[model samples]
Target chain A: MTEKVSIKRKVKCALLNILMYISCAVICLMLAGIAGYIIYRGAGGVTVDLIVNKPSLLKGTIGILPNILNTLYIIIMTLAISLPLGVGSAIYLNEYAKNKRVVRLIELATETLSGIPSIIYGLVGMLLFVQLFKLETSLIAGSLTLAIMTLPTIIRTTQESLKTVPGGYREGSLALGAGKWYMIRTTVLPSCIDGVVTGCILSIGRIVGESAALLFTAGMANEVLGIFEFFKPKMSGSSLTVALYMYAKERGEFEIAFAIALILLALTFIINALSKLAAAKLKGKGSGR
Target chain B: MKRAANFLEKAMNVIFTFCGFIAIAFVVLVTVFLLVSGIPAIKEIGIFNFLFGRVWASTAQSPSYGILPFILTSVYGTVGAVLIGVPLGLLCAIFTAKMAPKGLGTVIRNAVDLLSGIPSVVYGLIGMILIVPFVREAFNLPDGANLFSAIIVLAVMILPTVISVSETAIRSVPREYEEASLALGATKTETVFKIIVPAAKSGILTGIVLGIGRSIGEAMAVMMVSGNVANMPSLFKSVRFLTTAVASEMSYSSGLQRQALFSVALVLFVFILIINLILNLVVKKDVK
Candidate 1:
C-alpha cells in the first residue's frame, strides 16, 4: 500500500512540474513569437522614404513624418502640463498635507482616476475640451486629456520616491532654519528626482501606446503641422498608433501598418529599458542612503 | 528679505495645495461630464429598452438603440479571457517566483514588461494580420474576426498584469511556510502548490481582478480583431464589445446615435468603477 501511494504521488508531482514548465514555455514562446514575427514581417517596410516624407495622395507616396511630429508635439505638451501638477501633488501629499483624511480623499480620487479607462477619458475630453472649452479636436485638447490620465502615474511614483527620502534630510534642513518650501526645493526634490524621471518615462510609454483616448479628442487628420499649428483650434493630427490603425483598418495597407507597428515596438523597447534603468538607479540610491 | 521669504513660502503652499486638489477636480469633472451627456440619451431611449433591447441598428431607418449585445459581449469576452489567462498566468508566476533560476526569472520578467509596454494598436495590427486569418482557417468559418479571436488577443494582453501581480504575491509569501512544508516530507512542487500558493491567495485574486479590469476596458485591440457587429455573442460569432461599440461608430454618428454612444461609455465607466471598488477592497483586505 505504501509503495502504491508513493507511485501515485510521484506521478502527481511529475505531472504538476511538467504543467508549470509548459506554462512558462508558453509565455516565453508567445513573447518570442510576437517580437520575432513583427521583426520578420516589418523590417523591410521601414525605409528612409517612409520616415522622412509626408504622405501625399497626389504623388501616391506613403509617409509618417506628420504622425511622428504629432506624436512629439503631444508628448511635449502632455509632459509640460502633467509634470508640474503631478510633482506638485506628490510634494503636497508627502510634505505639506497634515490632515490624514484629506490625504486619503486625494489618494482615493487619484486611484479612481487611474481606474477609469481611457475611452471614458476620451469621451469626457471630447465633452470638456472640445465642446465646452472650444479647443476643437486639436492636439492641445488631446494633450490635456492625456495629462489628466497620466497624473496618477506621475503622482504615485513621485510620492513613492518622496517616501524613500530620509526624514533626516528634511529635519536637518529645518534645524539649519531653512524654510519648508526651500528645504523641499533644494534637498528633498533633488534626491527624489529619479522617481520623477521614472514617472516621466512611464507616462511617455502610455502616451506612445495610447490611441483610443486620442481618436475622438484628437481628430485623425494626417497632415504635417507646425508648432504653432498644434495650438490652433481644429488642428487635428494622428499619432503613429492612430496612423497604424488608419492604415491597417481603413486603408488595408498591411505593409505600412507593419512598419508602424515595428516602430512602436522599438519605442516600447527603448522606453521599457529606460524606465528599468531609472528604477534600478532609484533602488540603488535608496539602498545607498 | 524675511518678508519676501515668508511670502514665497505661503505662495508655494497655495500652489501645491491647488495642485493636490487637481486630481479631485478632474475626477469630479469626468463624472459630471459623463453623467450630463450620458443621461440625456438614456432618458430618451428609456432605461429598460436601452439596457435590455436585443437589436442595435443605429443607422437603420427606424433606428433601434439597444445595447444588450454589447454588454453581453463585453461580459462574455472578459470571462473568457480570465478563464484562459488566469491559470496560465498563475502557473507562469509560480515558475518565475519559485521554480526558475535567477537568470531565467529576470528574462521572463523583462519579457513580461515588454509585453505590457507594447501598444494595443500593435497588438491589434498583429491580431488583424495573424490571429484573424488563423482563426478562420482553424474553425472553417466564413469570418475570422470574432469573439474567439478577441478573447485570445485579450488573454495575451492581460498576461503581463496577471503574471507580475501574482509573481509579487507569490514572492511575498513567508519563507518559513515553504521551509516548514519541506521539513514535513512534502516534495518541492507539493509545497509550492499546496502551501505557498494558498498563502498567496489574496494577491492572486487581486491580480485576477486587475486582469478583468484590463480585459473589460480594452478597446483598440478588440476593435481591430472583433468584427464590429452588434450580435448576441457566441464563441464563433463576430460581435462588438461595449468599447468597440462606442469606438466603431463615433466618427460619423450624430444626434441620438452619438448620445447613445456616450451612454454606452457611461455603462462602461460604471463597470470600471465597480471593479475599482473591488480592487480597493481586495488590496485593503490583503493589507490586513
Candidate 2:
C-alpha cells in the first residue's frame, strides 16, 4: 500500500512538471511563430519608396511618411497634455492631498479610466472634442482623446515611483524651509524621472498601437499636415495602425499593409526594449532609496 | 512681500488641485455623454426589445434592432478566451517565476512583452490572413472567420497580461510556505500548484478578470476576423460582438441607427463597469 501511494504521488508530480514545461514551450513557440511570420511576410514590402512618399493617384505611389510624422505629432501632443495632468495628479495624491477620502476617490476614478476601452474614448472624443469643442476630426482632437486614455497610465506609474521616493528627501527639503511645491519639484520629482519615462514609453506603446480611438477623432486622410496646418480645419490623417487597417480592410492592399506592419513591429520592439530598461533603472533606484 | 509669496503658493496649490480633478471630471463627462446620447434610443425602441430581442436587421426596411446576438457573442468570446488563456498563462507564470533559468526567463519575458506591444490591428491583420484560412481548411467550411477564430486571436492577445500579472502574484508567494512543504517531503511541483498558487489566488483572479475585460472590449482584432454579421454565437458560426456591432456601423450610421450605436456602447460600458468593480475588489485585497 505504501509503495503504491508513493508511486501515485510520483506520477502526479511528473505530470505537473510536464504541464509547466509544456506551457512554457507553447508560449515561447507562439511568440517565435508570430515574430517569424510577420517579419518574413512584412519585410519584403517595406521599401524605401514605401517609407518616404505619400500615396498619389496620379503617380500611383504609396508611402507612409505622413503617417509616421503624424504618429510623432500625436505622441508629442498627447504627452504634452497628459504628462503634466497625470504627474500633477500623482503628486497631489502621493504628496499633498489632505483628505484620504478624496485621494481614494481620485484613485478609483483613474482606475476606472484605465480599464475603460478605447472605443468609448473614441466616442467621447467625437462628442466632446469634435462636436462640443468644435474641433474637426483632426489630429488635435485625436491627441486629446489619447491624452485622456493615457492619463491613468502616467498617473499610476508616477504614483508608484513617487511612493518609492524616500520620505527623508521630502522631510529634509522641508527642514531646510522649502515650500511643498518647491520640495516636490526639486527633491521628489527628480528621483521619479525613470518612473515618468516608463510611463511615457508605455503610453507611446498604447498610442502607436491605437486605432479604434483615433478612427473617429482623426479621420483617415493621408495628407501630411504642416506645422501651420495643424489645429486648422480638416488637418486629419491616419496613424500607422489606422492606415494598416484601411489598407487591409478598405483598400485590399496587402503589400502596403504588410509594410506598415513591419514598421509597427519594429517600433514595438524598440518601445519594449526602452520600457524594460526604464523598469530596470527604476528597480535599481528604488532599492537604493 | 510675504503675503504676495504666500498668495503665489496658494495659487499653485489650486492649480494642482484643478489638475487632479481633471480625471474625475473626464469620467463624469464620459458617463454623462454616454447616458445622454444612449438613453433616447432605448426609450424609443423599448429596453427589453433592445437588450433581448433576437434579430438585428438594422438596414432592413422594417429595421429591428435586438442585440441578443451581440451581447452573447461578447460574453461567449470573453469566456472562451479566459478558458484557454488562464491555464496556459498560469503554467507559464509558474515556470517563469520559479522554475526557468535566469537567461531563459529574461528571453521569455521579453518575448511576452513584445507580444503585448503588438497592436490589435496587426494581430487582426495576421489573423485575417492566417488563422481564418487555417480554420476554413481544418473545419472544411466555406468561411473560417467565425467566433472560433476571434477567440483564438483574443487568447493570444490576452496572454501577456495573464502571464505578467500571475507571475508577479506567484513570485510574491511566501518562500516559507514552499520551504515548509519541501521540508515535509512534498515535491516542488506540488508545493507550487497545491500551495503557492492557492496563496496567490486573489492575484491570479485579478489577472483573469483583466483578461476578460480585454477580450470583451477588443474591437479591431475581433472585427477583422469575426464575420461582421449579427448571428448568435456558436463555436463554428460567424458572430459579431457588442464592440464590433457598434464599430462596423458607427462610421456611416444615421439618425436612429447612430443613436442605437451609442446604446450598444452603453451596454458595453455597463459590462466594463461590473468587471472593473470586481477587479477593484481583487486588487484592493492584493494591496492589503
Candidate 3:
C-alpha cells in the first residue's frame, strides 16, 4: 500500500509537469500562428519597387516606404520629446524627491496617465497641439501626442531601473566629494544604462505600435511629409499601424490591406527582436564589466 | 574651498528638487486640462444623468451625456474578457512557473514577450479575420461584431500581461509552502490551489487590476470587434463603449459635441486613475 501511494504521488507530479509543458506549447503556437498567417498573406507582394515607390490604389502598387518614413519620423520626434522629460522626471523621482507623499502622488499620476485611453490622448492632442497651439494635424503634433502617451511608460521603467542600482554606488560617489548631480551623471546613469536602454526600446516599440492617439493628432495623409514640414499643415503623415488600420478600413482592397499588415507585423517583430538582442547584450556586458 | 563646494552642492540639490516637482506639475496640469474641458459638458448633461442615463446622443443642440449605457457595456465587456483571460492566464502561469521543463519555460516566456509586443491594432486585424468570422458562423449571428467578439479578442490580448504578472507572483511564493503542503500528503494540484494561489493573491490582484485598466482603455481592438452601436446591452447584440464612442465620432463632431466626447474620455480617465491608485496602495501594503 505504501509503495503504491508513493508511485501515485510520483505520477501526479509528472503529470503536473506535463500539463505545464503543454500549456506553454499551446500559447506559443497561437501567437506564432498570427505572425505566420500575416506573413503568408503578405509574402507574394514583397518586391523592391513595392517597398520604395509611392502607394497606389491600383491593384498591386502599394509600397510602404513613405509610411515607413512616417513611422521613423514619428519615432524620432517622440523620443526627442519624451527622453529628456522622462529621464528628468525619473531622476527627480529616484534621487531628489524627499516627501513620501509627493513620490506616491507622482507614482499615482504616472500610473493613471499610462492607463488613460489612447483616444483620450488623441483628443487632448487635437485640443492642445492642433487647436490651441495651432500646430495643425502635422507630424509634430502626432509625435508630441505620442510622446505624452509614451512618457508614463518611460518614466516608470527608468525610475524602476534607477532604483535597481545599489545605494552604495551613490554613497561612494558622494563621499568622494562629487555633487549629487555629477554623481548621477557619471556613476548612477552609467550603471543603469542597460535598464534605461531596455526602457527606451520598449517605449519605442510602444510608439511604433500606437494608433488611436496618432489618428487624430496626425492626419493620415500618405504624403512624403518631411520633418521640416512641422510648421505646415500639408505635411501630415501616418505611422505604419495607423496606415494599416486605414488600409484595412478602406475595405475593398483586401490584398493591399493584407500586404500592409504583413509589413507592419514584420516591422514589429524585428524591432522587438532587436530590442531583446540589445537587452541581452547589455545584460551580458554589464555582468562582464 | 569646502564651504564653496557645500554651497554649490546645496544649490544643485535645490535645483534637482524643483525638477522632481515638475513631474507632479505635469500630472496636475493634465488633470486640470481634462477638468477644464469636461466640466461644462458634465454640467449641461447633469451629473446624475451623465452617470446614469441609458442613452448616449451627444449632438450639438440636444446633447445627452448619459454614459450609463456605455459604462454598463464597458463593464460587461471587461468582465467577459476577465472571465476568459484570467483563467487561461493563470493556467499558463502555472504551467510556466511549475510545470515546464528547463528550456520550455524560456520558450514560453519568449512567446509571451512576443505576444505582448504585438500592437493592439494588429490584434484587432487578426480578430476581424479570425474570431469574428468564427463567432459569426458558430452563433449564426446577424452581425459578426458584438460584445462576445470583443470579449474574446480582449481575452487574448490581455492574456500575455496576465500570464507574465501572475507567473511572477506565483514564482515569488516561497517553494517551502508548496513543499510543506506536498510533504503532508497533499497532491500537486491541491498544494497549488490551496497554498500557492492564496499566497500569491495580492500579486494576482495586481495583475487583475492591470488587466482591468488595459481592457478599459483598449480602443483599437475593441473598436473593431464591438458593434459600435450605442444601445441597450446584449451579449449577442452590438454595443458601444466609452473608448469606442470617442474613437468613432471624434472626427465629425464640433463645438459642444466634441467637448462632450472629451467629457467621455474624462470619465474613463477618472475610472482608470482610481484603479491605478488603489493598485499602487495594494502593492505598497503587500510589499510592507
Candidate 4:
C-alpha cells in the first residue's frame, strides 16, 4: 500500500512538471513564431522609396511618408500636452496634497481613466474635440484624446519614483532655505528623471500601437502636410497603424500592410528595451541610496 | 529677492493644484459625453428592444437597432479567451517565479514584456494572414473568420498581462509557508500547489480580471479575424462584438445609427466600470 501511494505521488509531480515545461515552451514558441514570420514576409517589401515619397497615382507607387510624418507629429503634440499635466499631477499628489480623501479620489479617477478603453476615447473625442470644440477630424483632436488616455501611465510611474526619493533629501533642502517648488525642481525631480523617461517611452508605445482611437478622430487622409498645415482645423491625417488597416482591410494591399507592421514591430522592440533600461537604472539608484 | 521667491512658490502651488484636478475633470467629461450622446438612441429604440432585440441591421430600410448579438458575442469571446489564457498563463507564472533559474527567468520576463508591447494592429495583420486560413481549412467551414479566431487572438493578447501579474503575486508568497510545508514532509510540488497557490489566489484573480478587461475592450484584432457580422454567437460563427460594431460602422453611419453606436460604447463602458470596481475590491482584500 505504501509503495502504491509513493507511485501515485510521483505520477502527480511528474504530470505537473510536464505541464509547466509545456506552458513555458508554448509561450516562447509563440513569440518566436510571430516575430520570425513577420520578418520573413515583411523584409522584402521595405525600401527607400516606400519610406521617403508619398503615394502617387501617376507613378503607381505606394509610400508611407505622409503616415510616418503624421505619426511623429501626433507623438510630439501628445507629449507636449500630457507631460506637464501628468508630472504636475504626480507632484501634487506626492508632495503637496494634505487630505487623504482627496488623494484617494484623484487616484481612483486615474484608475478609472486607465480602465476605459481606447474605443470609448475615440467616441468621446469625436463628440467633444471633433464636433463641440470644432477641431474636426484632425491630428490635434487625436492628440488631445491620447493625452488623456496616457495620463494615468505617466502619473503612476512618476508617483512611484517620487515615493522612492529619500525623505532626507526633501528635509535637507528645506533646512537649507529652499522653497518647496524650488527644492523639488532642483533635487527631487532630477533624481527621479529615469522614471519620467520610462513613463514617456511607455506612453509613446501606446500612441504608436493605437489604431481604433485614431480612426475616427484622425480621419484617413494621407496627403502629406507641412508643419504649418498640421495645426489647420480641417487638416485630417492617418497614422501608420490606421494606414495599415486601410491598406490591408480596405484596399487588399497586404504587402504594404506587412511592411508597416515590420516598422511597428521594430518600434515596439526599441521602446521595450529603452523602458527596461530606464527601470533598471531606477532600481540601481534605489539600492545604491 | 525673498518676496519674489515666496510669490513664485504660491503661483506654482496653484498651478499644480489645477493640474491635479485634470484627471477628475476628464473622467467626468468622458462619462457626461457618453451618457448625453448615448441616451437619446436608447430612448428612441425603446430600452427593452435595444437591449434584448435579436437583430442589429442598422442600415436596412426600416433599420432595426437591436444589439443583442454584439452583447452576446463580447461576453462569449471574453469568456473563451479567459478559459484558454488563464491556465496557460498561471502555469507559466509558476515556472518563472518558483522553478526557473535567475538568468532564464529574466529572459522569459523580457519576452513577456515585448509581447505586451506589440501593437494591436500587427496582431490583427498576423491573425488575418495565419489564423483565419488555418481555422477555415481545419474546420472545413465556408469562412474561417469567426468567433473562434477572435478568441484565439484575444487569448494571445491577454497572456502577457496574466503572466506578469500572476508571477508577481506568486513571488510575494512568504517563504515561511514553503519551509513549514517541507518540514511537514510535503514535497516541493505539493507545497507549491497546495500552499503557495492558494495564498496567492487573490493576486491571480486580479490578473484574470485585468485580462478580461483587455480582451473585452479589444477592437481592431477582433474586427480583423471575426468577419464582423451581427449574428448570434456560436463557436464557429462570424460575429460582431460591441467594440467592432462601433468601429466598423462609425465612419459611414448617420443619425440614429451613429447615436446607437454611442449607446453600444456606453454599455461597454458600464461593463468596464463594474470590472474596475471588482478589481479594486480584490486588490483591497489582498492589501488587508
Candidate 5:
C-alpha cells in the first residue's frame, strides 16, 4: 500500500509540474493570439493606396503611409544620434575610465533615467525642446526627445556588452605595444561587436515601441510632406501608436483602429524576430551559443 | 611617435570622460528642471496639501493641486498589474530557464521578445477593442473601461519585462546547486524552490523592482483603459493616474495649472528615483 501511494505521489508531482508549464505557455499563446487576430482583421486592408494616399472620410479607409514615413524618419534620426553617444559612453566606462565612483554614478543615473516615467520625459521635452529651444513641434524636436528617451537603454546594453569583453584580450593588445585608443578601437570593440549590435537592435525595438515622448514632441499630423517641407509647422504625421490612439479616441472607428493595431503587431513581431535572429548569429560566432 | 601617441591617447580619454560626465549632467539638469518649474505650483498650493490633497482640479479662481487621488490611482494600477504579472512572468521564466525542452524554451522566449516589441499604443488599441467590450458584457457594468480593465492590460504589457529579467537571473544560478539537490533525493520541485530560487532571490527581486518601475512609468496604454476619471480606484470605476492626468491636461493648461502638471511629474520622478536607487544598491551588494 505504501509503495502504491509513493508511485501515486510521483505521478501527481509530475502532473503538477506539467500543469505549471502549461500555464506559462498560456500567456505566450494569448499574445500570439492577439497578433493572429490583428493579421486576420487587417490582411484585406493592405494596399498601395493605403500605404501612399491621404486618409479620407469619403472612402471610409485609412492609409498609414504618412505615419510609416514619420516613424521611419524619427527612428533613423534617433539611431544616428544615440548610437555614437551610447557606444562612446560605454567605451569610456569599460575601457578608459579607472575611477570606480564616477562609473557607479553614471550607472545609477542611467538606471534612474531608464525608470523615469516617459510622461515626465514628455513634460521635459515640452519645456526644453518645444518652449525653451523654440523648435515648435518639428520632426527634429521629436527625434531628439526620442533619442534621449532611448539613450539609457542603448547605454546600458552597450555597457553590458562591453563588460563581457574578456580582460585578457585588452591586456594582450596592450602588451603588444598598442596604444590605449588603438587597443580599444581594434581589440576591445572588435571582440564586442556582437554585443554592440545587440544593444543597437534592442534600442531600435524600444524606439519603435515608444509613444509618450513622441506625443508631445512629434506633433500629430496624418498628412505626408515633401522632402524639404517635412518639418513644416502645420504638417502632421501620425505614427502607428499615435494613429491607433486617434482612431480609438474617436467613436465609430473601431474597425480602422483594429486594423492599424494588427499592422502594428506584425511590425513588432518582425522586428523582434529579426533581433533574435541577429543575436543568435552573433552569439553562435562569438560565444557558446 | 610613441610619446606623441600616449599624449594623444590621454587627450582622447579626457574627452571621453567629459562626454560621460555630460550624460550624468543631463540627468541632474532634468531633475532640476522638473523641480524648478514645479516650484510655482508648490508655493501656491502648499507642499503638504498638494501631496496630501485628493482632488485634482484646475480652475481660474480656486485652483486645486491635489495629487493624492492620482497617486492612489497610479499605485493601484501598478500594484494590480504587478500582482497579476509577477507570478505568471516568474513561472514562464522558470519554465524557460530550467524546465522546458530546448526547442520549446526558444519558442517561448521568442514569443516574449515579440510581445515586448509591441508598442504601448498598439496594446491600448487591443485593450480598447477586445478587453474593453468583453469586460463590459461579462461584468454587466456601465462602462467597459475601468480599473479592472486597465489592470489586465497593464499586466499583459509588463509580462515581457518581468519574464525576460527573471529568466536571465534564473539561468545565472549555478547548475551544481541543482545537481546536488537532485543527488540528495529531493524532488525536482523541492530542489527548485529550496535551492534554485533562494540562490536567485536577489536577482528575482531586482527583476520584480524593475518591472514595478516599468509599470509605474507606463502612460500611453494605461491612459487608454483607465477611463481617465480622477477618483478613488474601484474595480468597476473609471480612474485617472498621475501619468494620464498630465497627458490629458498638459495641452490646454496654462499658468499655475501647467506648473501643477509638472509638479505631478516631479512627484512621480522622485518616487521612481527612490525605487531605482534602492534597486541599484541591492543589486550592487549582490554583485560584490
Candidate 6:
C-alpha cells in the first residue's frame, strides 16, 4: 500500500538529505585543501641538496640527512627488537595460552597500552631509559620507547592472522609426526607473513610520525652519524618530525620546515598505501576462495 | 634423547609465556614510574591547592602550582571538539555508508584514511598558517592562537575516526532492520536516522569517547595553536592544556616546577585511565 507523506515529513527528509551531502562535501573539500596547500608550498622547497646535506650554521643552510638517517635507524632498531617479541606474544596468546582468564588479562594490558598517550610514553621513556638505565638521550632510547608503543599493534595483527591459519593444517602436520613447534614453523607462521608485513608498515608509520617521545629521549642534533654510531650510548639525533618542529617552531624557518613536511607527507602516503596492500593480501589469503 | 626433547619443549613454553606477560610488565613499569615521579610534586603542593587553585605561576617569585586552568582548557577543548565534530562526522558517515555511490564511497574512505595518516604536527602547522590568521582577522583579536583555534583543529583532526567508526557501525546494522522500517512506510532518511543510528549508538559513543581522548592528549598541535598561556580557558583567550603545560615547561624547568609538571601528567593520566575504563565497561556491557 502506498501511503501519502505529510508536508512536514517531506521537508524534514529533504533537509536531512541536503545536510548529509553538504557534510560529506565539506569534509572532502577540507581534506583536499589541506593536502593541496601543503604540497604546493612544501614541494617547491624540497631539493636534492636538502636531502643529501646536513644543517650547517656557518653556511646558513639546512638539510635533513641526519634526520632521515635517525628515522631509519630507529625503525630498523625498533622492528629488529620488537618483531620477535610481539610475534612470540601473539603465538602464546593464540596457540599456547591454557586459561581464558590469562588471555583476557594480556588482551586487557594490550588495550591499556594502546590507549595510553605518546607524551606519557615520552616521560616514562625519559625516566626509565635515560635515567634508570643510563642510556642517556639517544636514538636507542627513543626507539625502545617506540617499540613498546608499537607492540600492541604487532601482537594484535599477528594474533589475528594466526587465528585464521586453518586448524586442519595443524592436525595434518601432527598426523605426519611433526612436533607442535615444527607444525607451526612449517604451516602456521608462513601463512601469516602478510600480517607481519602489515604490522611492520603500521609501526613504521607510527615511528616516522612520532615526535614528542623522541623529543625527550632522542635529543635534537643535526649531525649525521655513521651506522655504528647509532648504538653509541650518548648519541643524539632528531627524527624528521622533530626536525620539522625544530625548524618551524624553534628556528622560525618555515621554508626548511615545509620541505621536511613535504618529505614526511610523501612518506605517510607510501606507508598508507603499503599497509593497504598488506591488509588486502591478508584478507585474500584468509578467505581461501 | 627423549628427555632432551622434553626439556626443549618445556623451555620454549616457558619462554613464550614470559613473552605474553611482557605487556603487563610494561604497563606496571609505566604506572609505577609515573607514580614514583608524579607524587612528589603533588605532595609538595597540597592536593586541593594543586587541583582546584586557579593561579599557575610556575616561574614567579613564589611559584604557585595550580592546574585548574589546564584541566579546564583540556575539558573545554575536548567538549568543544566533540560537539562540533560528532554531528558533522555522523552526517558524513551516514552519507558515505548509505547514500553515496560505490566509487564515491571508496574515494571518500581513502580521503578519510589520508586525513588520519597526516601527522598531528602537520595539522598544527596548517592551523597555525590558516586558521590562526583567519580567527585573528575575523575576531579582531591580537592573537588568534587560542582555545577556539585549538578546538577547530581538533574538530578536523577527530573527524577521520568519527567518520570511519560510525560508518562501520552503521554499516554493521542489519539490513533487515532498515528494510523493515522502509516496509512500514517510513522514508529512507527516516529509517537511517531513526533506526540505524539508534542501533549503532554504542559505537558512535565509543568514537566520541576516543575523539575526546585524542583532543585531551594532544600536545604538539595544541601547543602550536593554543597560545600556551596559563590562563583559564575562554573561547578566544590563550590557554594551556594539561599536555602542553607539561611539554612547554619540561625543558629547563627545575625543582618544584619539574615535579609539578609530573603531577600535572599524573592528573592527565588519571583522566585518560578513567576514560579508558568507561569505554571498556560500556563496550563490554553492550556486547553482553
Best by DockQ: 1
lDDT (tens digit, per residue) of candidate 3 on A30-76: 98899888888777766787668777667546667778888888888
Question: For model 4, how does the per-residue alpha-carbon lDDT over A85-170 read when each residue is reduced to its tens digit?
Answer: 99999999999999999999999999999999899999999999999999999999999999999999999999988988999999
Which residue pairs does candidate 6 place in steric collision? none
In candidate 3, stretches whose alpha carbon ends up further than 4 angstroms from where it belongs are A1-26, A56-61, A230-234, A281-289, B1-15, B59-65
Q: Which model is ahead, 1 or 5, in terms of TM-score?
A: 1
| Per-residue lDDT over B1-288 for candidate 6, one digit per residue giving the tens place of the 0 to 100 score | 777767877787888888899999999989998999999889889999999999999999999999999999999999999999999999999999998999999999989988888888888888888999999999999999999999999999899989998899899999999999999999999999999999988888888888788778888888889999999999999999999998889878989999999889899999999989988987897798
Each candidate's lDDT (Cα)? 0.94, 0.91, 0.81, 0.94, 0.80, 0.90
lDDT of 1 by residue, A49-78 (tens): 999989998999989999999999999999
List pairs with backbone clashes in candidate 3: none
| lDDT, candidate 3, B29-123, per-residue tens | 66788889988888877888888888787763666667887888888989999998887788889878876677878888888888888888888
What is candidate 1's lDDT per residue for B1-288, written digit by digit as tens? 999999999999999999999999999999888888899999999999999999999999999999999999999999999999999999999999999999999999999999999999999988998999999999999999999999999999999999999999999999999999987788889999999999999999999999999999999999999998899999999999999998889889999999999999999999998998999999899889
lDDT of candidate 5 over B1-288, digit per residue (tens): 878998989887887787577578779878989989987888889999998997776863776778898888889989999999998888788878888899988888888888888889878877877898899999998898999999999899889888888889889999999999988777777677678978988888888888888888888898888789887777889998888888988878888888898888888888798788889887987988
Q: What CAPRI class is candidate 3?
A: medium
Q: Could you estimate the TM-score for every candidate?
A: 0.98, 0.98, 0.91, 0.98, 0.92, 0.98
Listed in order, the DockQ scores are 0.80, 0.76, 0.54, 0.78, 0.64, 0.75
Best by lDDT: 1
- Reproduced native contacts, each prediction: 0.84, 0.75, 0.60, 0.79, 0.67, 0.60
Which pairs clash (backbone N, Cα, C closer than 3 Å) in model 2?
none
Model 1: residue B205 alpha-carbon error in angstroms:
1.1
Clashes of 4: 0
Give a tens-digit lDDT track for model 2, residues B169-268: 8899989999998877788888888899999999899889998889899999999999888998898999999998888898899989899999999999
Model 6 accuracy (lDDT, Cα): 0.90
Error of 5 at A287 (Å): 2.9
The sequence of per-residue lDDT tens digits that candidate 5 reaches over residues A1-289 is 2223367667866876876687687887897788887787767776777777768679776678778888887788778877778778888888777889988888777777778877888888878888788887767777777777777877776777777677888899999988888898898888777767777777777777778887888878887766776655534465677777877775547666777777777777777777777677666755652
Candidate 4, residue B21: how far the Cα is off, in Å: 1.4
